[model samples]
Target: MSQPSLAPYVLKRPWLMRWAKPLSKWYFDAAAYRKLGLRSDDLIPEESEIMQRAMKRLTPKESYDRVFRMRRAFQCSLAHQLLPKEEWTKPEEDIRYLSPIIAELEAEVTERQGLEAMVINKPNTKR
Candidate 1:
């Protein structure tokens, strides 16, 4: 499951964004996933039904690349090493590929729940 975020609120106000941007950058650097050659989305567990379905929605190339990243990161972990700086996941390369799919799936689930919980009434008709 996705963690709750105040990012939307932070991003909408220029003053807040200015204050948060550097902090966010520092936090992300501290998290050190880039050095492990993994994007943020790559950390999402595939255990949940939504995540499983979201992963199924990935294009073949995206799926392959994700698996490759995971395998490489695993190897790095075993060796207790970071990727070479040139190969570290750059900021641009850390874009959300799976997040949009997960959002869409969550929307669909919400919509389905809303529809299921709806009540309808019909007027009687004369013959």
Candidate 2:
């Protein structure tokens, strides 16, 4: 399969984030779904380099439908697949792989809440 892209974008540029707000508000405020999407979508391209340079960075699962209600488990499974035992010896090491994606999720949530204002306004926060 082709590798995935993890390029970041503004909230307005991505129509899904904008339009999903109403439904998001109805369900966990969409923060969890958005975080799952953020992690899942970001797994591919960064996989190789991340696994090599920062092997702890676990990868999220590939397929998820937020409407299905099982998305969180899917997200966990994705991470398991992305960072299998054969690849990582320790859980902390695998957790390192998740740092970048988790950071992005936090920023996205903050932006959506209008709390911190914008991703750019906050420090780079990348780990």
Candidate 3:
């Protein structure tokens, strides 16, 4: 299961969002994945059922792009070098691509479980 996050609550408040924005930015910047040309979503582990489902849902182009990024990142890291600054993933390009798919898959699983667990209640009158 996904960890509970205060993101929704913080995002709902302009003041909190404003306060957290730069902190989040700094955190991501420090992560340095952008320097290797990888988006944030590219770091998500693909070992679980939910992630596998999410992977299957990706468009062909998206899947190809994701693999390309991972390979490129791997090469860069192994070489102990970074992508050229111009080649680094742009702030706008580092958006979460797989997260929405994973969330959707998780929702589907939860809904299926709820439906399967549902019990029907019946009322009877003397016939």
Candidate 4:
């Protein structure tokens, strides 16, 4: 789930972001998941514990949509075909839905670990 990324570096610089945006879009388009009516987040494997927790956190509608997209993509793969152009995922529609939840879960786990490691020392009572 934690893939190495240059996103933070690019995002920190407006000029670099401007140059990368179109190239990233072009790369995404060439990757062809949109042709199968799937968002980038939809392609994330659900086998990881973090992803499983994130899936549980999704709203009913989002859960349903995720499953629908996965099944549709599977069918497309089996048939060796892409969805119709009109049904393909658009750039704006490919927002990060699950990633935010996963990040939140990761943060919570880190916070929990920090709390678990805390030590409190009481001052001397014999004053």
Candidate 5:
């Protein structure tokens, strides 16, 4: 057989070029900012005071849900770049697959917050 067309073959292989564009875009857009319902900075708190004020406006559960949804939307956009066009179109399926992982992360954040509160409440306790 004749020698294979190397460049064309490389592009055809999903594993080889799958992350090419998405990873590049991620590097370029490192800010993770979006302008949907509100301006990027408006939705995202820039300082401790803003975060605290926003948290006060939202109940604990509401804030958690709001944050989770925002995070998912961002994840979908990022994942779209990494996934093939066909896979990217089915965002619901992607969300289903990713939900558990997000939940685990959220739980970890909640656990860390609880630990911080405990430490603040009982400063003398090393444990």
Candidate 6:
């Protein structure tokens, strides 16, 4: 399971969210994946079963786009150059495409485990 995150906590408070917004933007910009034409979700490690399942759940077009971005990013990394600024992923375009699916899969796994562990009892019928 993914570790707990403070994102919800910060988001619930306007003051904390206001303070965090600029810092988060700066952090994402400094991370530089956007410069390589990749969305933040594109960087998620695919080594785990959850990620693999989430990837399989993606629409064909999204899957194709993801592969294209990864290849482009890989090429850019090898060439030691970023994509032209026009092609860089904009902040608005960096939506959480994969994360929701991953979360759904994790929830399903947890639900299945809970159901499997459930106990059943037989009613007494002696009269």
Task: List, in order, the clash count of every candidate structure.
Answer: 0, 9, 0, 0, 0, 0
Question: For candidate 3, what is the lDDT?
Answer: 0.92
Best by lDDT: 6
TM-score of the candidate numbered 3? 0.87
TM-score for candidate 4: 0.88
Candidate 4: what lDDT? 0.94
Over the full model, what C-alpha lDDT does candidate 5 score relative to the true structure? 0.47
The candidate that wins on TM-score is 6
RMSD of 4: 1.8
Kindly list the per-residue Cα lDDT of model 1 for residues 7-122, writing each as its tens digit: 88887899999999899999999999999999999998888999999999999999999999999999999999999999999999899999999999999999999999999988
Regions more than 4 Å wrong, model 6: none
lDDT of each: 0.94, 0.42, 0.92, 0.94, 0.47, 0.94
Predicted structure 5, TM vs. truth: 0.27
Q: Per-residue lDDT tens digits of candidate 3, residues 65-118?
A: 999999999999999999999999999878888998888889999999999999
TM-score to native of every candidate shown: 0.89, 0.20, 0.87, 0.88, 0.27, 0.91
C-alpha RMSD for every candidate: 1.8, 17.4, 2.0, 1.8, 17.4, 1.5
The segments of candidate 5 whose C-alpha lies over 4 angstroms from its true place after superposition are: 1-42, 81-127
Instruction: Point out where model 4 deviates above 4 Å.
Output: 12-15
Q: In model 2, which regions exceed 4 Å deviation?
A: 1-95, 115-127
As a TM-score, model 6 comes out at 0.91
